[model samples]
Target: MIDSTISSFPLIGLVLLLGLAIGSFLNVVIHRIPRGESVVRPGSRCPACGHRVRPGDNIPVIGYLRLRGRCRDCGAAISRRYPLVEMLTGIIFVAIAIKSGLTIDAALEAIFASAMIALIFTDAREQLLPDVITCPLLLFTLLAAAWRGGWGEPVAYPFDLSLVFATESETGFPAMRAAIVGGLLIAAAVPSFWLIDRLDIFLFNKYHDWQTETDSTRQLTAEEETAIASYEHQDRRMKRLAMAIAIVSSLLWVTLALRLGNHDPLAWKGAWSGLTGAVTGALVGALPLWWLRTGYYLVRGVEGLGLGDVKLMAGIGAFLGWQGALCILLISSIAGSLVGLWMMRTSTARLATAIPFGCFLGSAALAMLLKQIIWLAA
Candidate 1:
């Protein structure tokens, strides 16, 4: 037992180190993604002087300590967030390793937690949640759910459709039904994307046009041009990707249904269950918020929630399933209210102050994730 315990230490240490490196990359993501800068093109550089960060000075927390939190070339002070993010990631990774013990679930949890950390910081700093992060995250979580066979339990599909649509086979498997449901859900993405695009055009295009008209005589800065180009490119890529996934998923389902019929439905049961859970979770997570946002806009004549928040919730739902997503919403709402009250008491903040609700949501999601890990460990 002693030897086994000691041997595991190396793996734990490695996980921690890898997490710190990921955190460094996340810092880059949090900073550049919202600004429409490519995370890959330019290497890490001193924002103050644009000097490339030297290899020796980029060693996570150690590098910060060695350089005394100042750029080597420009001597400009670095934000404390860099090292803090790294340390926090390292610690969280270690805790996950300890609790979940170097499993695939542990890896997925680490990835989810890292993304949450990035979202937390990015939203807090920029009041923006880039689709670059949330969209891919949503896709990944759906895929991961399928890979995991489901969110560890039977999904309580909204409207109790599972009972109506998810009929069991002779072998007690709902493989065909699950495949059909999941396929339909995936195919729905294509139309969903179209609807979202139309909504954006209806809601935001006028404001964009107004800005363009107002600034018609003014020259755009180089950075502004780059950001615009980046955003447009990303938007196109995401649309294409979503369409491709929807088509491919639908085709795959058809193939499976035709080939299997009822003979061998048991083989793919887990995958179908996972897809169903993920799809249902995404809907459960985003729909309530979307309804609230629409209602608030109609009544209050102001946008209550950014679309990014809705997308973020969808991703979270895909990862955690409907139950976890709803829990996150409830926890985040309570936490946001408490923070708002505290801010009002301490400063000049009012009830209407624009709070970064995404930060709270991300934090709540992380807390929920940790709680799950701890529960499993216990």
Candidate 2:
């Protein structure tokens, strides 16, 4: 058990400061990622003016306050979103720190909070869950799991030596092995995504018959028709190439995972458990959406969800485990359905209107995490 009460105000202040800084960075990610812009380069700039923002002007909430919510160079009104994101991040970080304390779990939770904030804002604004964020997050959680499980040295009570790829007592490289295995798993995502995409394309072709409207009123030139045919042929070849890459990557990952799993299964400790949990969580989280996507296409001949949603779920599952992942799915679906229904009733949206499902997932996952923390504390 831990106390949420801050015995020292300075510690609380430091945690809040850290949170604000992370939130500031997240704002950059939200703004740049969807635009396919580099978050690191070009630095922060006033949206209304081309002038680069000064370091003093980029100081999170304080910067906004000092600037009076207006750009110094152009005097253009800055969006309230910037300060809001910074505050939200700081609050979430402070909450997690209070709940989890300054341990590995606290660090992990903070990372999770940052990811959720980024995903929520990005999805809400652009309906995208960028791979740049989700892919790295998945890798971080997998490695964190191994570290927390005592991969190299015994640290905590929940230590499980069985999770290591090799016997910790014998090999003395348990943490290293876990790290390598985790890395391999992370690398596997690229191929897995390619395979999933290829399968989707195949299913689409098999289930749907397609013919472009002949502009039935206008006859196409011979060259134009030939160009269209050539494009279709090239597209088919590209899909085939993608499928081949997926296959090779799948085989490579499987070989690595199997080689790692050759150690005693019964001795599986916290590290191994974390790896299995992540893999299982990813499948559990992704399969439902995949099924839904396929079914929707089969019946409606339209994609009801984006592939980005699937990757987002897999990333969430990697951090939260299968049970938590399932919980997030259920909650997000319910929330999305309710909101969708309301939108339709209010004439704000149509059945075919795309909803940002990733936003719902991010929000729901954060809420669930808070609930879990509260429940455990009680």
Candidate 3:
């Protein structure tokens, strides 16, 4: 047993190395997704000089150290974010591996961790959470929940609606009820997107432009113009993709619920429970924020939270369930408030200063996930 344990060390090391590579790719995602650029097509290049990064100079943390934090071609200083993300991801992957022991749960957890890290950095630097990450993440979490039985915390409904749907068989009620509940929640949430869009148009007279900049008076260079056009095109494409994903996911949920309602409930009980929990979690996670966003706009005539945040929370809910989602919201809100207070005290910026709330949310979500993993291990 001891020899076998010793041999496993190499596997853990490999996982760590793979994580570092994934982190490098995540850096590409963080940078390009926000800019409406393709993460796959363009190879790594010096942002300042547009020179392709040489093969030897692209080795994660070591490459950054070898380059001395400067581009080889133009000598422009490279952002330390590269090494930081790579190291962080490697550490997270190693920790997950050690705790979960190369299981499917560990893989799922690693994916969640990587997405959270990307969102945390992307929101911190760009104040944007691209749908390209959150939308797919939402779908992944729902599927993961169904696969894993549940997120550990089973959702508790306030009232017992099972009585109304109870049938002759003892097991029939649970599966049928869960299916009905999940379907209803999914159906309710679908129209929210259209409603939010309509609200934005009604209140603001236009869709909220995330790409709007303050430098409207400046003359744009030809390159800058090209970049902006590319960004806009990519943004549109991403939105369409997000819509497609949302539609397909919702339809799958409803279809599965219908099918599950007719089958033997015992066979798919775990899946039904998981699907119900995920749907409830998504609604609980997103609706309150939507309410706050709408109320704030009505009262103040300005947007308080971005729609990306609502979607981000929904993804968190799909993974962690309603209880975890609420915990994340509470923790992030407190942290954001404290940071805003500190900023107000230290800087000249006023109350209207835009704080990256998604950064706080992402950080809280990661911490909560680690905490849960540790608790389960203990």
Full-model lDDT, candidate 3? 0.74
- Alpha-carbon runs more than 4 Å astray in model 2: 1-6, 151-186, 205-268, 372-378
Candidate with better TM-score, 1 vs 2: 1
Which residue pairs in candidate 3 have backbone atoms (N, alpha carbon, C) closer than 3 angstroms, thus clashing?
none
Residue pairs in candidate 1 whose N, alpha carbon or C atoms collide under 3 angstroms? none
* Best-first order by TM-score: 1, 3, 2
Q: For candidate 3, lDDT tens digit of each residue in 324-348?
A: 8889989988998999899999988
lDDT (0 to 1) per candidate: 0.74, 0.70, 0.74
Worst 10 residues of 2 by lDDT: 206-215
Q: How many Å off is the CA of 71 in candidate 2?
A: 1.8
Of the pair 1 and 2, which is ahead by lDDT? 1
Each candidate's number of clashing pairs is 0, 8, 0
Q: Residue 24 CA error for candidate 3 (Å)?
A: 0.3
Where is model 1 poorest over a 10-residue stretch in terms of lDDT?
Answer: 206-215
Q: Per-residue alpha-carbon lDDT of model 1 for 135-217, expressed as tens digits?
A: 76776676667656633333344432344556665345565566666677766754664575477568645322211333578
Cα RMSD of all models vs. native, in order, equals 4.3, 8.1, 4.3
lDDT by residue (tens digit), candidate 2, 1-378: 444655577998899999999999999989876555657788899888879999998998999999999999989999898999999999888778777677667778789889989999988886667656765565555556544543432223222223434555653334445545554564565557557767876877642111222134567777656654654454455445544553554354345445654464323345555665666677778889878877887898666887778878887776676777888999989989998888888874467635789999888778766774567657
**Which candidate comes out best when scored by TM-score?**
1
